[model samples]
Target: MLEDLDALSLRVQRAVQLAQGLQAERADLMAQIQQLQQRCQALQTQQAAERDEFARMSERLARHDLELQAAQKESAQARGTLEIQLHEQRAHAQSLQHSLQASQADCDRLRTAASGAQQQIELILERLPGAEA
Candidate 1:
């Protein structure tokens, strides 16, 4: 009976020791799980922030695209207007050149007529009072 009692007591002590070791291992595992959960939450927050930044960048890119399109349209319109003005200026220059040519022709004709008239007047004066005297 004494031996049996000693064996029972030894068994009880080993069981208590085993239970205490298991409880300590469970506490360590719980701490590890809590740390992993916190890391996951931080990653989630970082991902959300990155997502928001990406959206803002996308919006900015869209606005820039719109601005570029508007600039291109305005440039095209300006080029068209400049082309029209250039054409008009060329036409006006041609018209002025024609007018200058016509005026030059008329001036030449009037100079020829005036020279002929002066020769006739000189011949008439020689035939009149200045004859042989």
Candidate 2:
């Protein structure tokens, strides 16, 4: 009877260990999910800022276009002055446009990366026994 009691106690200890390990793993996974979610939010905010910058750049481009048209119309009276101002404005607009495009591309890339990370986390969670249910 004593031997049987010892065996039963050993089995209970092992079960407890298993449960503890599982709980630890679950906590780790939860922490990872939270960290990933925070990163995703940061990326989303950055994307929004980039989009806003793009909008501002577009507005600036429109204003530059209007200025260019006005400059052309005035060129007949002050050809040299209008031409210089037009060239400068055009150059500035081009630079802003390029910067906007680069920012947009970066935003898209970050969003894609965040999506991939989320998918990987989901996959990991799905593979876990309790998580699947």
Candidate 3:
């Protein structure tokens, strides 16, 4: 009977030690769960902020694209106007060149006629007796 009592006491002691160890382990698990929950909340907040920033950037890109399109259209119109003006200027320059050529031809003919008149005047003077005297 004494031996039986001793063994039962030993079993009780071991059970109490095991219960304490399990309680310590549960406390550690609870602390780890709290830390994980906090980390998850922080990550969620960061994700939301990143999403908002991405949306803003997307809108800005769209606006920039629209502005670029408008600028390109204006540039194209300016280019067209410049091309038309250049064509007109080239045509005017061509007309002036033709007019200059015709004037040059008229000048050459007038010079030839003047030279012939001068030759005739010299012949008349040479034929006149005592003209130099």
Candidate 4:
């Protein structure tokens, strides 16, 4: 009976040691679970920040596209205005050239008529009595 009681006490001591080991393992597993949860939270925050940055970039790109389109439209309008001014200037220059040509022709005719009149006067004067003397 003494030997049986000693054996039973030894088995109880072994069961107590096993229970303590299981508790320690459970504590370690709980600490690991907490660390994983913290890591997941940090990732979610970073993803939110990245999404905000992407939205800002997309808005900036859209504004730049609108500006580019406006610039293109203004450039086209300016080009058209310049073309119209150039055509008008060319027409005015042609009209001035025509006026100058007509004036030059009138001057030539007047010079010819004056030269013939001078010749007739000289001849009539020579035919007058003692005009040569």
Question: Per-residue lDDT of 1-133 in model 2, one digit per residue for the tens?
Answer: 9999999999999999999999999999999999999999999999999999999999999999999999888876688787888999999999999999999999999999999999999999999988846
Candidate lDDT values, in order: 0.96, 0.96, 0.96, 0.94
Top TM-score prediction, candidate number: 3
- Sorted by lDDT (best first), the order is 3, 1, 2, 4
What's the lDDT of the predicted structure labeled candidate 2? 0.96
Off by over 4 Å in 1: 1-17, 125-133
Residues 97-127, candidate 4, lDDT per residue (tens digit)?
A: 9998999998899889899999999999999
Q: State the RMSD for candidate 2.
A: 49.1
lDDT of 4: 0.94
The weakest ten consecutive residues by lDDT in model 4 span 124-133
Residue 74 CA error for candidate 4 (Å)? Answer: 1.7
Q: Estimate each model's TM-score.
A: 0.75, 0.51, 0.79, 0.66
User: Candidate 1's residue-wise lDDT over 1-133, tens digit each?
Assistant: 9999999999999999999999999999999999999999999999999999999999999999999999999999999999999999999999999999999999999899999999998788778975664
Candidate 4 residue runs with Cα over 4 Å from true position: 1-22, 111-133
* Model 4 quality (TM-score): 0.66
lDDT of 3 by residue, 46-112 (tens): 9999999999999999999999999999999999999999999999999999999999999999999
